[model samples]
Target: MVYTAPGSAAFSRKRGSMADKITAELALIDTELAAVELGDIELNSGEILVGNAGNVATAVTPSGDVTVSNAGVTTIGAKKVGKAMLVSESEAVAGNIFVSTGADSAIDEVAVSGDATLAASGALTIADSVLDGSNVANTSPDNVIGAIPVLYRIAVEDASANNDITSTHKFLVTDFWFVGGATPGVAEDTVQLLNGTNAISEAVAKTTDANCLVRATQLNQSTGMIAAGGTIRITSVKNTNVAGTAYVMGIRVA
Candidate 1:
């Protein structure tokens, strides 16, 4: 072509055509933008439009595991767990729970009318028991004879004439046993067992070997040997006659 000035008829006509093309393109862009702004875009279910950091929304179709984050208060009617599972803060009331075998393991409420039997493969530990034969099996809640509670064990070398043995706590003496030094088979030592001022078992012969004397005859019977906070004073007839260490073991029931 040929060069022409800006005010020329040919130049003005070409410039007008270019301006028309630009105006038409801009109008088409405006129409498309209006459609988008009106939310005219359609999507299938589960498809979503995500916004970027620039706040521009782009259509995205997620596959595999779609993470739902920052959603508050999700509720489910029922959930099934397969294989091993862990959960926190589970609670069970006084109701029956059944495994696949249909056996019911029920927890009853606190006892008001009758006794409740607790049976389990594990131990049933009772912190406090008001248990009795009516509630517990093979339970002698009142019997203390079967229980051996050692109140005090006194050891002395050649106990003096008025050797006194004191106990911190009072106990009901079931039986008193003493091991003293003596010639085997030679009964030479004699000891008196006294409860405070009274002699419970007097002239009790102790040999070189072990001597177990049951003071059932001397016991108060209504109460055991001695009341709580009571003491027993053991006296030796001849201190030099008793050769070895005199160990006095007192057995009692709590």
Candidate 2:
């Protein structure tokens, strides 16, 4: 057996053996380092390193609408988010709206199916008569003819007989008409209107001299504006002369 000093060949051999073991261990470390080398990594600009299984590092290179920097800074591209990403665009239209049919579901259009519909020309129309006078919910007038005065219709039968005609109610005399039946009142015969006894009209003519059929409007009111319980008296110069049928037309005052 040879005794070897610290600097001797045997001692150097022992050191070499330890160095060989260290080199073998270092080889494994070098292999692992080579597997994760910067050259092996395919990271471009805007990339971040991510650890895989068993501590294997991988380069996460942002693509498409996003990017990552070598410093691990990340950014997303602009205008990449479109309507298709947000909604199911199969039902999209110009005037249509996005309507969610169910909760937690994607929204789309149901434009024409609703009460109102829109045309392709951007003209919106209500379905059928949905917005007409009948369907519209509103406080309508109980009487549609608001504030319009009613037409006072005098019955033709009431003024048929030619005599002292007394009105059934208080009346405002407006017009008078006459048609000869066998014996018509003469043209000069004055058909006077009276409120009880006081005369309201000067002389309402029964008929014209040329013809028995006569119509006159706005009879003169002498006594006052109107007559209550008025009487249509045939006052003739020749009294007791026969007179035919006549109509006293007026509005009810009372």
Residue-level error in angstroms, candidate 1, position 20:
28
Supply the TM-score for candidate 2: 0.29
lDDT (Cα, tens digit) per residue for candidate 1, span 1-254: 22223445544455457778567556666776665642466755445688978899876655442322223233332343322232222432222222343346533333222233333333344545564212322213267545444534454345446666555444555555455554422344666566776776545565545433322224333433554456666666653354333333344433
Each candidate's clash count: 2, 5
Q: 1-254 in candidate 2: lDDT tens per residue?
A: 22222445554555457778557556666777666756765766766778978798786666888776667676768998677876565646666656787977967565665687777677877777464222322221233433222122222221323246554444555566555444445545545444556654555555433336655544566543344355555443333232544455544443
**Candidate No. with top TM-score:** 1
Q: lDDT: which candidate is best?
A: 2
State the lDDT at 28 in candidate 1: 68
